[model samples]
Target chain A: MAFLARIYVTPRADVLDPQGNAVAHGLHSLGFGEVTEVRIGRYLEVRIGGSDRAAATEQVTAMCERLLANTVVEDFRFELDALASDR
Target chain B: MAFLARIYVTPRADVLDPQGNAVAHGLHSLGFGEVTEVRIGRYLEVRIGGSDRAAATEQVTAMCERLLANTVVEDFRFELDALASDR
Candidate 1:
């Protein structure tokens, strides 16, 4: 089967996010006082050809752990949708 | 009112994604042959204090247009959640 994975990799809440802080500061300077905090992360869409949903889940999880996310400081989650069956 | 905005910024389908291509190549080299393609983008969480939904939407739309997205090469979409009523 063909599957599509939408992955979100975000920094753990306990971690200090300088980028987010900087963005919030910039927004404040731009006169958006209502803007409080900003957190930035990564979004990925991965297309995979796999046997089934279970198999795809395992594969995507491995991908997230091995390459997609910095598991020490960041956390990752994903949703998978079946695209089509392989020919 | 308090609102949380989950924003997704992605490269347009027609845009050239060298980063995606490179990541796909890396995955293939790492033996994840089932991985076909990878498109990478940015995810942002913005917390805002506003008067109402209509006001928040207008504010966020301006943020996207002016600072959040490039608008030329990327497209952005966001979902807003009301956090709580102000004290």
Candidate 2:
């Protein structure tokens, strides 16, 4: 089965996000006063050939831990979908 | 009303994604053979105070153009939800 994994890697709450802060400031200056906060992160789309959902989940988790995300400063989450049906 | 907008900004398909290529190579070297490809992008969570969903969407679209994404090389999409129920 071919699965598409959509992953999100976000900065840990304790980590300082200078880029996000700067964006928030920019929005305020642009007259977007209604925007209260902006947090930036990474989004990844991966296509995996796997036996089943469970197998695909395990592989994607390993990928996230090993390379996709910096675990020390980022937290990762994902959603998996069968690609054929979606297509 | 408070709305939460989840946004994804991805490099245009024609754009060269060197970082994604490097990560894919690393995955192959690490023995993740079932993984065929990886594309990297940006994710953002924005909190917006608005009178209604339509108003919030318009504001967020402007935000994406002016500050959230570099439209020259990227494409963006978003999903919005009322924050109260989600919380």
Candidate 3:
């Protein structure tokens, strides 16, 4: 079976996110006073072929550690869905 | 009430994504042959204060159009959850 993994990589809470701060400032200037905070991150969609959900999760986790995410500065999470039948 | 909106902005399918292509190539060279394609996008978390969900949705949508997303080359979707009690 094939699986599609949707991963989100976000900077650690303690990290300084200048881009996010800039966007927040822009929003405030535009009169969106209700919008208090904005944080930006990376979204990734990865397609993989595997025999089962467990195997696919293992593969995707390895990919995250090796290439998909930088654990030192970012944290990652993902959701997997079977895609063979949808196509 | 307060709500948190999680937004994802992705390049339109017809548009060219050089960054995504570069990541795919990098993965291919790293021996992940099962990985077929990769699409990169932006993930954003917006914290908003409002009295109701419908009103909050309206505000968030307007924010997306005005600043949160670039409607020309990208498309966006969001999920909202009330956050008043979480704290």
Candidate 4:
């Protein structure tokens, strides 16, 4: 089976996110006073071929732990769906 | 009222994403041979104070148009929700 995974990697809430802070400042300067805070993260789409959903999920999780996210300061999660073209 | 927006900015399908390619290579090296393709994008959380849902939605749209995305090469979308602690 083939699957597509949508993965999100976000900084742990307690971590200081300098990039988010910078974007918040930029939004403020642009007159978005209503904008109070900003948090930035990475979104990834991974396509994988595996024997089944469980195996695909395992592969995606490993991908996150090993390559996509720095687990020390970030948390990662993903959703896997069977691809329409899997046939 | 306070609202939280989850925004996604992704490269257009036609654009070449070098970063995505680099990650695919890394995944292949890590022995995830079943990994076929990868695309990377940005995920953002924007906290806003607005008068109403309509206004908040407008603000989020403007933010994407003006700063959050390069519309010519990227596409952006968002989900807005009423914050529970708006009081």
Q: Highest lDDT among the candidates is held by which one?
A: 4
lDDT of each: 0.90, 0.89, 0.87, 0.91
Please give, for residues B1-87, the per-residue lDDT of candidate 2 as tens digits. Answer: 699999999989888888888888899999899887788999998898875999999999999999888999999999998987343
iRMS per model in Å: 0.7, 1.1, 1.1, 0.6
lDDT by residue (tens digit), candidate 3, A5-87? 89999988888888888988998899888887888999998888766899889878888899988898888999999996544
**Candidate 3 lDDT by residue in tens digits, B1-87:** 689999999988898889988888888888777777788999999888776899889888988899978899989999999987543
Greater-lDDT candidate between 3 and 4: 4
| Residue pairs whose backbone atoms clash in candidate 2 | none
For model 2, give the RMSD to the true fold.
2.5
What candidate 3 keeps of the native contacts, as a fraction, is 0.81
* Per-residue C-alpha lDDT of model 2 across residues A1-87, encoded as one tens digit per residue: 689999999999899888888988999999999888788999998888865899899999999999899999999999998877333
The estimated TM-scores of all candidates read 0.94, 0.89, 0.92, 0.96
Residue runs of model 3 more than 4 Å from their true location after superposition: A85-87
**DockQ: the better of candidates 3 and 4:** 4
Report clash pairs, candidate 4: none
Q: For all candidates listed, what's the TM-score of chain B alone? A: 0.92, 0.89, 0.91, 0.94
**Local error of candidate 2 at B65, Å?**
1.3
- Which lDDT tens digits does candidate 1 get at residues A1-87? 799999999989999889989988988888889998899999999999976899899988998898889999999999999886753
Error of 1 at B15 (Å): 0.3
